[model samples]
Target: MKPFFVILLFSFLILIGCKGEEPLNDSIIIEVKTAGEKELSDLINNRNGKYLFLNIWATWCLPCVEEFPDIVKLSVNYKSDKIDFASLSIDYIEDKENKVIPFLTKMNTTFSHFINGFKKDEALINFINKEWSGAVPLTVIYDSSGKQVAMLEGAHTYDEFADKLNTLIK
Candidate 1:
């Protein structure tokens, strides 16, 4: 009986120690994929019953860098079954490891993001929106049926994002 009690106490101590230990930072991996015009078209066409919020940006763009945190905030706050968030970096595909991933890591981004793999800039530009002037920090939202609902072409606040999402979601 004494031996049994000792074994039980040891198990409890081990469990408590495990509970107090933090997960290794290296265990969390962030992978940013590359998407070409065809992949982007497929994504926009198939939203899987959720409103898609797509932010087109580039690491070299100052406005995009400044507006990223707010987009990150919205991704955290508004993430739900009704809506999804994603980002497309216009940076050259070669920058995926060095520039794009590092920027996303700094932003603590968890949502799916991709680096543009389009060979021709005009192809990507027209694929996204015909009227878009190839602008950085462009945000567009699409409903569940894959129809574009909003096109915001500049940096916007967290509230502005929330407001637009709220109107569509509600």
Candidate 2:
């Protein structure tokens, strides 16, 4: 009986030690497109008859990272066949392959992904949305007619994201 108790306690300790350790997926490969002012403009103008959900984020931003799993789930649930789902990372050009790709792989984001290609910060921010103050984890919703409907900034829970997406989806 004493040996059994010791074994159970040891297993419990192992489980506790493994908590919050996320494994990096080195096998999953993805190509993150580079989008500057031109590509962004093209996307906004070219998307037809599809509701677009665009999330602007970065690997370094904690709030952005925290909300990513929810975004990935939302993308899977509400795909482009019914609506458009995309993500844009504002990570520096050098970190595209080093940071963005690895993070996306770990998060399992298989949707439309992009990295900022332009050098100018303010220019890119203004181009995305003039009102945007270059904030990370910015989410923009556009209707089928290419009209901006909703814009959410900062970290959002899965329920919060779902609520916002539902409002725009309808």
Candidate 3:
């Protein structure tokens, strides 16, 4: 009886420990098209006269996650032919939909996904902004003429985001 009780106690302890040992969901993979030779041309030429809201973010950034809701709200509230919102995740190529896609799906984000395939962080930083300093949460708003009008780095509240959009819309 004593041996059985000891075994039961040990089993309970093991179960409790194992319960908290769930694996981290960060390694989930997403299917993303690496911007190849024609990718930039397609993105630019295809979006000739439309306003583009390009957000560069990653799943690990807290500020990026926090600001995502407002971006989603902005997309939902202002559905227009003149405006295009594209969210580009800097997550690893192998972990696109796995990590970032699930997060976006859970958040109900409607914007399209663009995943960066270049392993070199410097290339991405230089491509987005020469002075980007390799930040995770960077947003660039380009006007109809393909000129960047605003570039925001860091989390923004819904109202703050709305204000920015309002300026562009008007």
Candidate 4:
């Protein structure tokens, strides 16, 4: 019984230590997490001390797919203590396993990712930003206080992304 308990304790310690928090040495593959509007809102609101770089995209959106590698690059090159990065996939919830995850994996994304959970497309758009025209490649920046500081619609260059984030961080 004591040997069994000792083995269990070691296993628990290993699990606790391996939370996948290590920095990605290479952009190879990653599993995207899923969240609804409320959960996503909460994530944004909770980023109080760090700048938030949130990009709204979809697997099927041509520009979104085209711009994905750049987003991943920014996440890697600009990794900092004061800034954070995340990507939100607006793909259908049913396609996460088949479409969304595979796409992200193919992109070798290192940053944390999310798949939108809203069943209604309009509601998701409004929840993100009422002014948005339901675009597939939208980007928004939030300051340390979780207030939106900048936004860019459509596909953007790596410099564009870095420049906007630089302004906010400064």
Which candidate has the top score in lDDT? 1
Candidates' C-alpha lDDT:
0.88, 0.83, 0.76, 0.84
lDDT digits (tens) for residues 14-40 of candidate 1: 999988867334454678878986777
**Model 1 stretches astray by more than 4 angstroms:** 1-27
Tens-digit lDDT track of model 3 for 1-170: 99999999999999999888653443433344566325644664576678888888889888999888888888888776477888888888777757877787666655667788666878767766787777778888878776778888877787887788888878
Clashes per candidate (backbone, < 3 Å): 0, 0, 7, 0
**Top model number, TM-score:** 1
- Give the per-residue Cα lDDT of candidate 2 at 170: 61
- lDDT, residue 138, candidate 2: 93
Off by over 4 Å in 2: 1-28
| Candidate 4 lDDT by residue in tens digits, 23-119 | 4333566667777867888878898588888999988899999998998898888886577889998888788888888788777777788988878
| Model 4 error, position 54 (Å) | 0.8
TM-score list, all predictions: 0.82, 0.79, 0.74, 0.79
Per-residue lDDT of candidate 2, residues 11-113 (tens digit):
9999998885656764656788999878877776677788778899999999999899998898888774457788889899799978988889888777788
Report the Cα RMSD per candidate.
5.0, 8.3, 8.1, 7.7
Clashing pairs in 2: none
TM-score of 4: 0.79
